[model samples]
Target: MRFPPPNPLTLGALALSMAFPLHAQSDPSTAATLAPVVVHARGADEAPKDLPYSVDVVDGITLQERRLLNVEQVLRATPGVNVNSSGGANVSTIYIRGVGALYPMSMDDSSVALNVDGSPLSTRQIAIGTLDTDQIEILKGPQGTLFGGMGEAGAINLTTRRPTREWEGYARAEVGQDRQFLTEAAVGGPLTDKLAGRFAIRSAGSDHWIENDRTGGPLSKPRDLAFRGSLLWDLTSRTSALVSAERHRLRHYGEQLVLMPYSKPASVDMDPGLFQDSRKTIERYTLQLDHRFDGSRLTATSAYTDTYNIAPVVYDGKLQSALGRGSREFWNVDEAKERVFTQDLRLSSLPQSDVFWAAGVSYSTSRRSYDTPRNTYGDASAKFRDFDTDRYGVYGEMTYPLTRRLKLTTGLRQSWDRKTYNARYHGGGMVQTDSRKLDDSFTTGRIGLSYALTQQATLYATYARGYNPGGFNDYAAQPDDSKPYKAAKTDSFEVGFKTDSADGQYGLNGAVYLNRVRNNHLLSYDSATYVVSALNADTESRGAELQAVWRPGDGLAFTAGVSFIDAQIKTAVHGIGDGDVQAGNRVPDVSRWNGTLGVTYRKPLPAFLGLSAPVLHARVDYQYVGKRAADPQNHFDLDSYHKLDARLGIANGRAEYYVWGSNLLDEQYDLYGYFAPPSVAYGAPARGRTLGVGVSYTF
Candidate 1:
């Protein structure tokens, strides 16, 4: 199944050929223009063009067109964003502007805040079903004033489609390589004079593509099911209420971690019995209420989520072979459960006013429990831990017009957090228990000024401060490793501009930023001793991003985005290395340069048979990711790589069909790399070329 690496010259020729339209047709009287997208990540609804920071939006239409199955795919084409996943549906890490946690712990929260329908996500290992998406908003920068401590880097906000009064529905089916099949259906309409309801469901299953050399069969097969339902009711002329419920379940045979020095096509030379089975289930419910006055609006939201995951896995990949044993024996059965509850209340003035203001208060609580049973060389042991966290915050922001074309904005937030942990270990005729508590209170804010250079252009500058709270490491087997780490803080400054052409055919956004971070919480793993710890250090990061979209006549559109970042450690800490050895090292998992280019074209066809007018569409996409360091000392580096995708489709008002190919060039790359037990290098390779066909019908 291995394919030769693509030649640069051949790829260039192919890209050029695909960029041109296949069939030239007369231009329609009405030319489409890029629409202004509104975002709610800033604690208020506002147009992205009016914001002072770097923000990007991906609509549901684009998601359908791209056939994106996960958040990582959606973020790869976005500017100033990077995603690293370890060959699982939910195990993903996101980095923005070189600010991210390279190695995340079970208890340590992420640097970026992830939200679905205004409810914050507590765990990064939970699946994000994209069955009925409305839009995804990416806000890049320090957002501590509104989003709390996890917004040190930025935030990702996902909104799902709501019930509409009009009757509408769609059904889609897809078939792909490696025995993959997917089906999705949605229906919505008015249930009564003042009530509307919607329901959506998605189911998918795929056989493993990677093969195990020892067993001569596929390594892992995965299956998933998800369901969502929503209801909207108008209680009165000025008041309304909405409620949503969702459930998702996933089961997979196992995860395949390829050994270092492996050849292309990703084959594992290990015992099939060493693999594990995994299952995950998640459920969520949310309620929203709104009331309007003459000049202002009141809003309230409440949400609850519960998640459970279990896996039986082998800890050492090469244990049987390295120990000269004939069978696999060392293993661990792990289980994790989490429950979260959140509520938020806010009031804001109408957006049309000269002076805009919003204030909100939020309260959230989360509980997590973990259990693991290990069997190594006939020795048995078990470990259990529980964590509870509570957070409360009050935040407010205001924007005042300084003159006709100038405005000043400021925001402030005060937050308090408390966390408690309990651990129990039972092994070797001994039982031990430990308990600890940690708490912190802090203040964060943002200030900015914006000026309109012209009717179509705006320039802005901002300064913000953000922090990630400290937490105790649950994986620590020793007393010294159980201590809580200090909180990490960042002071950031950014300057940016948003502009549109007078003819409304081109748009551009760009930003330059500098960030200084202190007491930066870092995760370190000792493969030899199987111990994990957290430390503190100082780091500095500087970056710039540019994005542009162009639309000419004749049904043509093009988009290009690029980003450059330089992030390095300014001070060395314990467990990394000597002071000078680690001080100047490049930050792990941060790429120096990344970019994406896209081209799309469409042409209408003459009406035929009873069918209405149809359109032929073609698209090409390209992405480039630069080299990245895998460790603190920068000894191991992942080489730069590029990927290309293309799609050809035909569509009308009610039905559509498309053929799509991802990684058309068959480029080989690593998603991420880490040290396995016994200092073995292990990584997950990116998927190879995949070709699929899909059809959808709407009624």
Candidate 2:
């Protein structure tokens, strides 16, 4: 299951041999070009290149041809974005503009708003689909005025392919290293007059490939299955409705972080009976309604979702096995359940005049509770917490032309939040029960100005303010120690420019931003008692990003993105600490430098088979992540690493076949590193190289 590491030269040659189409030719008229990207965040279908804001759109063609299946892969090559994970697909959080906490807390509100088809998703939820995707939009800066409470920092919106009046479908299958298998299919068509239906399903899994030295068996077998169905009804020429239902389930050995000085050959020194496994289930249903009038549109969206997850990690295992009776009796466990309901109603004026506006009201309610996370250590060694949040907001935005080439834009949100908490903790011979309530109301907004410099270029500047309400830590057994941490208020200033060639052959987008956060959420590890407490401090982050896409001719496309960021805490915090954090510390998981490069080519192949010449498709992607602080305390640093992914295949309009490789060099890096209960540093290593072959057929 392991491949020997390759040198840089070998890596290059391997990528080129498979990804370079030397004996292929393309019809000059059919070469794909860099077209204007349309995004929906502006309250309407507006081309991002024409707008003043910063939006990165990954289109469906790229997603399909590049073989980017999951959320991580889809965002890996994006500028100014990072997904810090704990080795498990579900155990991760995303950081945008260097403004997200890597640690996972079921009670903490996410800094990034993850939306799928207008439905909000929690931090641990699977926010992307493996099939039937339309596009993904990554919007920078605060989006509170439009995306609601969780949009304090940024937003990621994933839209799924809709039901079509014309019959269409695709089925794909892939087999990969480690005995991995994937198969997905989607079908959409008109079921009846005025009615259309779509259904999609995906099933994927991989055998545990990490050899266990103790037993010579693999460490984890990971897999997942997801299903989605939707119905669209054209009630009238001016009104329509869409209803969708989805369910997903996952299983795997999660968070397999070994001791320091990681070894090679894809092996782990996990002890026998490690009790390492993770499981998750998600069910969601949504309804969307739209009506159009002479000059405006009205829309309504509602969703109900329930998710449950359980994961056991041996981050603190060495201490337990040496002192406790067995390893399974003492590892750390995380189990939680959440249910959410959301509704959004909005009206927007059509782009029929120089003046355009939108107004909307939103309401959402969420309830979450955690089950005792300590394994079978003891009956009384348990922790329990319950959190319920009810939030409502009203927002409005307007854009008007101040001059022939100048425009002004502004928006605001009036928000009210109510949260209730209940907790009970019994561990280390201590027992505590506490209940608290939080009620707050706040206002957030943004204002900006943009001017058209030419027919193909626009310049813009903007300021935005966003906030995250205070929260509590159930593990703080004492009342004062459990006091709510201060709310995180953020102010962001940004300038950006977007331009594309008049011929539509290339485009460039760039932005610079500064973000100041008051009462930034931080964590303090009290090593004296081996406990963690939530605290607050101040932080400042400034960064620049550039993204470019170029298509010269002859079926060649190139994409490159780079970002530089300096995000750190500028001051010391309050409350408990044993060097858990300090002044002038780099924000954990915020890499100082990161970038991605991609190349794709397509051309008609020579007549080899006894059929029409098929098109040869090839793609290569490279990514880099600069070293970063692994934990708040700066306990360790994750070294910089390089990764390469490539795919080569042939397509004959309706069917395709390909071979792909991920991390072809077997590059190794820690996904995350954290301290165990007793101060030992442990890390979860990223997955090793994966090679696979796939096929897809369309009808």
Candidate 3:
């Protein structure tokens, strides 16, 4: 398939924002195992069977049924992916194939690139809910040829629900333990003969959920709100144009942490005098144009985003200092504003023959300014920094049939990056200013071969190179440490197979991969000064993954996925506090093994008791994460834990009512923890158990 198949129907009116608008309804596949899995990761719609690499996809119905509202929840069931969130979305870090560093996180480049629709976004900017989404895809391996620098491990793409021809809409309300509540609604439909429009809104919040020892009460509350709108115009029978806009605001309080040895679940002991709130706001806009030719399509996408964040905290976990009680608090006030713009143009062949090709060029620019107030030291100390970056790339990829049973794919890309950095510091017993500029270039490519073993099964192997953009340290104490750091790189190799049953009752797939890393990025925190500096080293990671889906009988489905990884620092003569870790240490915050098992069943009930026919729905999911090192030194380890989630519901054609539970066993485990100042340890206790009730109505 090409891109979205054009329809005769289009939007009829120019709807307002996310208010009540004329609605359009979209439907999901009723059968799980037989549903077609098509993706647009390559600038066109195609099945996973045609691609040589591994890409996992989850549709909207699956997300809604499981209540996977955020990236953290979505990754639990995805093989070879992990997340470490420390209190808020801005601090969340994601690791793929055990490559990304999980060191409390910063607004830096991620090993896995994050994208919305066809545009790029920073990993730091997307901690919000994934509401009104059509599907989410994770393309594993080094996606160097098409996605540009930054995706050293892989890439994530989130596709939102688009407007349909017919009038339809949906509304849902959910309430859970601890006063957790969420509401969502979306409407889409034709506004005119040639135009279609869509609008969506999502809101979620929770009262205090974590126990506090000092106040003898619960702490930490969270609030989030988001809105999105889209307009589509069928300029002609062969061309279409789309415009989209979004805005999000989030506010949160409390760290939800427990005093060290990782002993409790959702409990903390602290006496901080006052608590400050962390807030983030984002605005985004995009325009896309597509034109279809006889056997090819041309596309152009442009996007822009503006983001602001403010986070303040108490560093000492005490109220002993006079500065802690007054205007001059003993803490830090961090604030920043960032702006980004990107453009991409491509022409892809909608081949009638057995040959396919795509060529594209992309350009992006970013600028950010940040400040830290003097409260951190309770003195006349502060830091201000500015960063600017530009990136450009050109890429081409082609797949050609070599013989009846074999196909060859080749891709190449050339990328250039330029960065300017500036920093100034006052007080803290030091005053300094630093300014620098750096430019770098890379050549990345992939080559693969695929063989058809049978009509429903295929085997393939590929090799690729990936690049991660270099960055500067804004949280530095000395001028020397403020200079930009060198970029990290990776070489990856993978072999995989995909199979589907002839009757479409089952599908199975597996892949094995190995990666060689150069100058991998890591963070070293200074104990005495509480400063963070960049650390670089070589490393190796190898893993195997298996996934399967089976439909044994009508109205019953089973899904399973498992992964095993051995990721270690190679030349690990890197400094941590006062000591250097040797080679062969496991990567921090990455699991050695993980797996997911899930079952879903739906049956139609015979009409009885003065009732029409209704559908009964039930689903259960189990997740496991293996042991992981807490830090590079391997001084402490986090134990493995298991989680079970269940849902039971009744539904008609347009209405559904459900009850759900997560972590039903109340398992105890640590989400993430670290030693502050290299001595006092604090950990964010994982959530214990929560239950909720929900109702949804769709047209």
Candidate 4:
């Protein structure tokens, strides 16, 4: 299907109308007040209104109320963000500001960086399980000076709940359609006068929503379990120590793909040999220490992470017969492991001072290995590869008040990266071996100016530079793939404003940005050899975002967000296989227009059924995602769609019960599309309407 291009004039008008200039508004009615939210995505903690860049924060309470199970769900409601999955629970791609990798192949690294408790996760794997969290912060635009190579596009930071002096705990259970079930619990308290401990656990799973017609069996099912523990100790009057650990296990059964353009919304027809079975395990450990002096503080953090994954399946579908293969089946097995260790140290002046300054140094090393074995009619072949990477960086930032109402900020970082690749192949009674080494060094920087127009309003402008280091391709079957690619870089400029009413009854924030990228890394798949590789191109993106929150009266609140992006390639390139990509094409997986609207009401209810102090809560939310191109050629696509979710409940302070529904309209949409062997195309389908009820208790 084809649609008309979006009109820029109409979009500009809409943005101006929705996000008028910051100005004071008068209202006679008194309303409840809202507190300012603080975020720490930068090196130091500060209120979002004071930052020169766009940032979004979601608290743990909102996550629970929405019953969000993964990071993808959290990002769907955020402005200027998009998520695409390969029809699996453990594989996904996230896009911010039209910058992201689009495929599930293990070789491509994500443009956006994700961190938990200051420890970065490998972008090659799925970032799941959002349990026992304090808050999630999303920083838009480049974070090069503070984060180094990984923050080419942006960054996401997750903070976990810490141990407390007083004992407290909570538990929740829920059951829903498709045999969905979930149970989670958390507890925290003091172990001794100076020692505190916290623990959390979660077990969740769901039956297959898609069924196979060939064998009358389920096409996909997911199960997951996770545990986290932490301990905090006051070493002395001026120093403290903290230790944390986490483990997660996930399993999936059956294939994650469906026959596109032919299969029904929730069904598939495939050969029994194509069934997929996979398992993934991840573990992480971290230790942190902090010392405070009269005017400054010193902090250090050390972290280690390990991940393992395995999958065995038939690569060829029923198309084997159609391609005149004579019932020959292709069996393949994949096993992979990754280990990373990182250390960071920083010193900063107290934020309360008129002049604030912070400096940090970081170092990280990672090792990864993978083995793939294939069996084609008793002809066995295997490929084995290993990768090693080491990175080091030093960064510093300073913010000084030039005047009572104006400030200037500047930061810079220098990074060095080195990578080594070793590969071996054995097949057809022959053996081959290869080795390569590559290294690069680069510098990134940021500059910003902020002005307080009024006591409650701030206006700012910023410029930043970021980059992603080059590396060897995992699937190096050809000479071109063996050579390392050049690093990708971006230059961005932004201007924004934030304002709030004196009574805190209304708030508004918006930004406009322009970004130019050079040597942008992209992933391409070869249908003939089933190999995925990397390529580079040039692109440009410009966009605007607006968000508003209002509390017109007691027990009533409304929130809305809107984004408009125009991203396109500036140069042509030769893709994998025999495909030529032309210039002037929109980047894949980026929507032109996205928005969200939400309403919430809470009120105290009269006592009933011998219950005392009961309160009722109701919420409704709607999201719109515009049509997007699936490939560089703009030949295949995903249509525009909308989703609605609602929740209603009653609760006291310690206990609550609620009923919730998602995709209430039962809309059917495609999450992603890909081309496979035998010239066939397939699409991963999104979920339909789902209804459930849950209960929770606090002690």
| Tens-digit lDDT string for candidate 4 (304-338) | 99988776544335434443454444555666788
- RMSD in Å for all candidates: 6.2, 5.5, 6.5, 9.2
Name the runs in model 1 displaced over 4 angstroms. Answer: 1-33, 123-126, 253-255, 269-276, 312-330, 375-379, 576-581, 607-612, 676-679
lDDT of 2 by residue, 328-356 (tens): 32355767788999999999987545677
Q: What is the TM-score (0 to 1) of candidate 3?
A: 0.91
Model 3: how far is 493 from its true place, Å? 0.7
What does candidate 1's lDDT look like per residue over 1-699, in tens digits?
A: 322233343344334334443333333324244556678866566877777788888888778877776566777667688776766654566778977764555544577888888888853643566788989888898888888798988888888889999998877776676656677778999999999999998877766666666777666667778999999999999999999999988887444456665566567665565444687888889999989999988889999988887765443344445434444434555677889999999988876677888899999999988767554533245778888999999999888889988989899999999999888777677777878999999888799999999978999999999888888775655455667878888898999999988776889999999988887767676644556677777778899999998988677889899999998988866553211227888877789999989888888877664336667778898999999986665667877889898888776555666888888888768877765443456677776788877766666
Residue 126 deviation, candidate 3, in Å? Answer: 3.6
lDDT leader:
3
Q: How would you encode candidate 3's per-residue C-alpha lDDT over 353-457 as one tens digit per residue?
A: 478899999999999877786565464678888889899999999989999989999999999999888888887578788888989999887999999999899
Query: What lDDT score goes with residue 347 in model 2?
Result: 95
Off by over 4 Å in 4: 1-35, 102-108, 253-255, 270-277, 312-331, 375-379, 478-480, 676-679
In order, the Cα lDDT scores of the candidates are 0.76, 0.76, 0.76, 0.75
- Model 2 weakest lDDT span, ten residues long: 4-13
RMSD of 2: 5.5
